[model samples]
Target: MLFAFSIAPAGTPGDSVSAAVADAVRVVRESGLPNETTSMFTTIEAETWDEGMDVIKRAVEAVQAHAPRVSLVLKADIRPGHTGQLRSKVERVEAALDEG
Candidate 1:
């Protein structure tokens, strides 16, 4: 499964939320799962639903330490019996573009 999520502290004083976001990303990185952090979201490849949700839950908690409330946006591509779709899926698209 590929789980992409964004977690941020809301109603904070500053215009920037990079610090809090970094905390969330740190959690993802520490998980040692196949993952990528982009400007909008962090995407992780997990073998099971529990694994992915556990990461997301911890990420939210990391951001929560920064503010009273947090905003989370989550999207998932749940394809069982598949692994490494994190890179393979993008590689397929890039290959298609090359073919075109």
Candidate 2:
């Protein structure tokens, strides 16, 4: 399964949540999972549903410390027996774009 999630601290400094975001991303990366982070979300590929959700759980905790409120947006693509789609999915789309 592949999960993409964005977690941020609300009521933080101005409109910039980078500092808190960094803290959360750090946890996700340190999990040693295949993950990609964009401006809005962090995508993680894990072998099992539990493993994936656990990573996101840690990330949210990491952000909660920085602000009084936390906001999270999560999306998931659950396809059993699939792996590496995290990168390959985008690669396939880009390949199609190139063909066009």
Best of the candidates, lDDT: 1
Q: Compared with the true structure, what per-residue lDDT tens digits does model 1 show for residues 12-70? A: 99799999999999999999999999999999999999999999999999999999999
Candidate 2 residue runs with Cα over 4 Å from true position: none
Model 1 clash tally, residue pairs: 0
TM-score of each: 0.98, 0.94
Per-candidate local distance difference test? 0.95, 0.94
Query: Candidate 1's C-alpha lDDT?
Result: 0.95
Query: What's every prediction's RMSD, in angstroms?
Result: 0.5, 1.0
Task: Write down the worst ten-residue block by lDDT for model 2.
Answer: 8-17
Candidate 1 C-alpha error for residue 20, in Å: 0.3
lDDT of 2 at 74: 95
